[model samples]
Target: MDKRDYYEVLGVSKTATVDEIKRAYRKLARQNHPDVNKNDPNAAEKFKELTEAYQVLSDPDKRARYDQFGHQATSGNGGMGGFSGAENPFGDFSGFGDIFDMFFGGRTARGPQRGEDLEYELVIDFEDAAFGVEEEIQVPRTETCDNCGGTGAKPGTETRRCTACNGSGEQQNVVNTPFGRMVNRRPCPVCHGRGVIIEQLCRECAGQGRKRVRRAIHIKVPPGVDNGTRLRMPGAGETSPSGGQPGDLHIVIRVRPHEVFERDGTNVYVDVPLTFVQAALGDEIEVPTLDGKVKLRIPEGTQNGTSFRLRGKGIPKLGSQTQRGDEHVRVHVITPTGLSERGKELLRELGRELGESPSEQTRTFVDRMKSFLGNS
Candidate 1:
């Protein structure tokens, strides 16, 4: 059976906002969830479909690719961009953590929450990306204050329960609807969701409980990393706002342009310009490889734009150290120009000695032209 459209699966429009999609998925998931609907045999399948649709539509890159290429582009990759569903769409959604939070209670225990994730684009040489390199980088992140030990209150001062929310960390607003009064719960303005008010601000962090610091981090880039590739480093992001786990740091790879080589996935491509005589009469040629120069055999009567592959001369596979890609060399025949009088005469004599007829290239073009003009 053909798969249903992702938008249709989630009952959302294609132009729906991220928040809208999330809310729709959550509402439907609660209804069709296997645990919620044990009597319905197909509830598990429906929940899976909802999760898959939410995962794809929630990611910006995957959604763009799906919009252009449809499901054919995003399937069979385990997940988009080599990641599992637990990491994206819903950050740190492993073990259905967020869903469980909603099913049980929302944000009831407000201990140290995890820090925010950070992204940095690191540009490197093409060779470095092809191989591997270790480099040191400086990243600016917010860390817990040392003066007050992560507490916003000043030394010897204590935090008191918020007067507005009465230590609930949230404020309730009652609105009168047509049916009845609707109550909306929001974070307390005085406590800012902390449920407590600091009498005096910390001297160092100004009551923020965190300070901006530039930290030096060392990163080891693996081989065969391509542009836009994101590497995750755990515990390297900003410190938790309330004292929880630190978020992961993501570094995006950007490879510099090479003068002779262009990379496509695991393959490397290079153009080799050969003289007409060399192409017509086979010769052993020296070709440039990433490591060093190697001899390449040019077959006799080799045509222009003939490509040859050198195995195991390209980049290593991303996760496999033993497997490597091939290097492709495209040989282009260069026609000699700026001929002297003697050189032209010699060429004319050689043409007559060989044959007065047109070469294969010229004959093929002439035949096409004649056919196009209806003179064939």
Candidate 2:
């Protein structure tokens, strides 16, 4: 039986562009993928057909040949997995760059390209996070060479063309088969595909046009930047081998844990322990803030877990001077523990005078529970 038309199978028009053909194939492949449709036995076959259709229709020369000779032209065109051997029915590898870039993301080739981005972690005190600070950081990196103007040549001489590729930068890889000819294009390994070689090397950079150096840079950290925040320093990363533009430097912030306070977003929370006497009698207590020690008044009969809000006392909002967050102080009344003999005796005497039992609250709770059970 004759096979289905490739364009109709992929649901694309004859006039569809290469990009449109690829998009349609990807959509159909995803829908009919074996992993997505495990119950359907034909899913694998459908996916294979979609890929084959894409491989043919996406190429200008391949599509022209198939249009004229039908399946005879693509029968042995080496169209990946299906055809036996017709690899290079067409003869150019320029179109394959986009396909490779889509899958590997620039990993296949690297020359005269920018250096990879770098990340640095910086630990700062809480005070610095609350109130912005300017700091000097020593960063070790490679920089472009000043001598020879980063051309990788000696003071007066220039580079020479590569004999392997004749300065074309691309090396044609031809595969001969009984069905037809196939071609694969890649960077020429010799001379690194730049189509040139440095016959005269630079004394300063050793012909690399870059060298390692350590430099100190002043960075201003914004206020309210919490841990895990990133600050970008453009063009501060390692230098490229070919003296290309430098990559970016990312500074990741790490806020040190404070001894007395914890941070949640812009709000600062602190647990303040107070004695029972102090909570009952109400006293002015000293509390620590980012600025300095400040007095906080505790109301009489203040209960445990009671929170007090101090406006404009927390960390300043990033990039704004007029706005600030609040600080919450949670009161935790502390009960006396491990009392002395004299203290225990005085406490017992006072309890008897006040007609208070040592387990007054607990006994009252038990009594309430009994009444509830009886009612039930």
Candidate 3:
């Protein structure tokens, strides 16, 4: 059969750059690879033709000759001598392994891999989160078996080398292709790439090298750790299946909402109820803080929703023992409700003394809003 043009085979123009040629070849090779398209009888032939075109065009010297003399340049001593040989027709194509690995489950010999990490949602009280606390938490994780010493063998009997792969943990498959035998190395099926076969199963762990057990781990939670804060505990997770280093345990902090206080990063906020008389006259009143109740001065004419900062009275800063956050005490004036006749009379008298007319501040605010609203 007559061979197709090299550029036409790869679907690339003669002026296409080396990178463009490589990209086009990879896309076509992946789609037409014999293993990927087993049902298509012509897939292997197409793939072989694509490889032949790529081998010549990819090399600069060969490509120059082919561009000048066409298929005549690839016929003699300078030619590839057809695809049948001990030599790989694909040449130094680096992307061949990637395509091969993708089609066939290209897993190498299994080695000791690190275990999976674990996440535990630790619900701590608001006070506990504000103040650093050492908590002993019970974590369910996989640990190496004590009886068989993580060998998955009986106490007396020992594990033997895998006969299927000859203890190499991998098996090489020789595939007969048009371009000679291709060797594909993958993990052994008998030993599952462990290189050893355990004839006697562990009595305790039931052939598995690890067992599930609940372990108590102490975690020192730092102060000012807000909700969703993750505390990583190294080597405190599940034991590795292949005997590598254990994974880390992530302690995700879930702070219980406080009844009295709300926290933001480092600062703490608390709404304190104040009597109208206390707000009007100004008095030293006790307000709740993270530490304890602290005396806050209610200045005369303190309005509702007035916030006062109590310096260094909030939650302690994380990782800094000396630095602390301020506590904001927002005062909400409690209006006198279900008042007696005498109480009402006293308030009326106080109101009359204060005057019913709008204050200077109130009049200025009203005028600004009227102007903003385009009202007279």
Candidate 4:
């Protein structure tokens, strides 16, 4: 089959930027990957086709040549992965490291690469979840070394050019084949693609360029932050292995269980038990809140399982809502288990005077069955 245009294969224009090209290639690779669709026999062929197209388009020099002279310019030249042995396909390829680093999550020729981010789990009290509070947390992480100034080098010395790659950081070779000569590029083992190497390791950081230490960081957790919420602290993560830049620290919120209250998102839920007399006579009772105790009134004849809402007493707003959530207190009327002799006599007299009986008070399906049977 005739080869498709490189731009069409990658779903991009010829003028697409390097980042755009990489994004397009990654998307295609994922869609047509053989491993992802093992049942499909054509997936591997499609992947190989796309890979070949990307090899030329991803390279600035090869892309430029292909753009000017079409396939004839790169006919005899090898594609990206044509080497039989260790060779840098990108030996003459400029702007290659930046593209590689962006896709593969590593430091390339790009300067000042940020460090790896760290995550720390934090547990807070129930009251703290309602009302925002500040607390200091001790986080053990890899931080930039102060002794060698984040460089993994001994004092009064610096990195030298790698002899293996001759400062190119990549080894390149051309392979002779029956069809044509193919060129390939691979990272130099000695230099590890850095183009430079430290002759003497740093004494303080042990040539790793970082030191592990504990830091006291104060975090202001906003109200309404529920369990599993994450707060990001910039420049608080581990130091970059290449001494490029500091990473960020992620604080994972773990709200401790409250004795009386349970939170669901920004809303607060609590179960309040009330006496039979209090529910019937209507009385004010003390309700616990994040700030302090507050008074709540129960209306007369308030049945069990009744819920009363206290507006603005629940958890605070996250980022969108301006008003706070309301607190819901579910009421459960408790009957007295133990009664004195005087209380029993008074209850007997009241029941007698009020004519309260099983037949008069009961209106269940059994009572309807009696009516249906004409026994009522």
Best by lDDT: 3
Off by over 4 Å in 1: 1-111, 156-164, 174-183, 357-368, 371-376
lDDT of 2: 0.79
Task: Report the C-alpha lDDT of model 2 over 1-376, residue by residue, as the tens digit.
Answer: 7778999999988889888898887677667755467799988678667767877887788899888888777774344325433443223324444443443345355556887787888999998999988899988887777887776678889788988999877687666633234445677888765678888889998986666678887899998899999999998888776557889899999999999989988889999999988987899998887778789999998998999999889988888988888899999999899999998998789788889877996799899999999999
| Total backbone collisions for each predicted model | 0, 4, 0, 9
What is the C-alpha local distance difference test score of each model? 0.84, 0.79, 0.85, 0.76
Cα error, candidate 4, residue 156 (Å): 4.1
RMSD, each candidate, Å? 15.0, 7.6, 6.0, 8.0
Output the TM-score of candidate 4. Answer: 0.68
Candidate 1 vs candidate 3: which has greater lDDT?
Answer: 3
Worst 10 residues of 2 by lDDT: 84-93
lDDT by residue (1-376, candidate 3, tens digit) is 8889999999999999999998898899889988778899999899988888987898898899898888988885436525434335543324466556556665432568898899999999999998978999999999999988888788999788999999997888877775455667877999887689999899899887788999999899988888999999999988888778899999999999999999887899999999998998899999888888878888999999999999998888888988999999999999989999999888767767877534755898988999989964
Q: Flag the better candidate by lDDT, 2 or 4.
A: 2
TM-score of candidate 2 versus the correct structure, residues matched by position: 0.71
Candidate 3: Cα lDDT at 362? 80
lDDT by residue for model 4 over 166-231, one digit each (tens)? Answer: 988677666553223334567788877667798887899887567889989999988778888899
Candidate 4 regions off by >4 Å?
A: 1-110, 156-160, 168-187, 191-199, 320-322, 359-365, 369-376
Residue-level lDDT for 218 in candidate 2: 84
The residue pairs in collision within model 2 are 77-86, 87-182, 88-181, 88-182
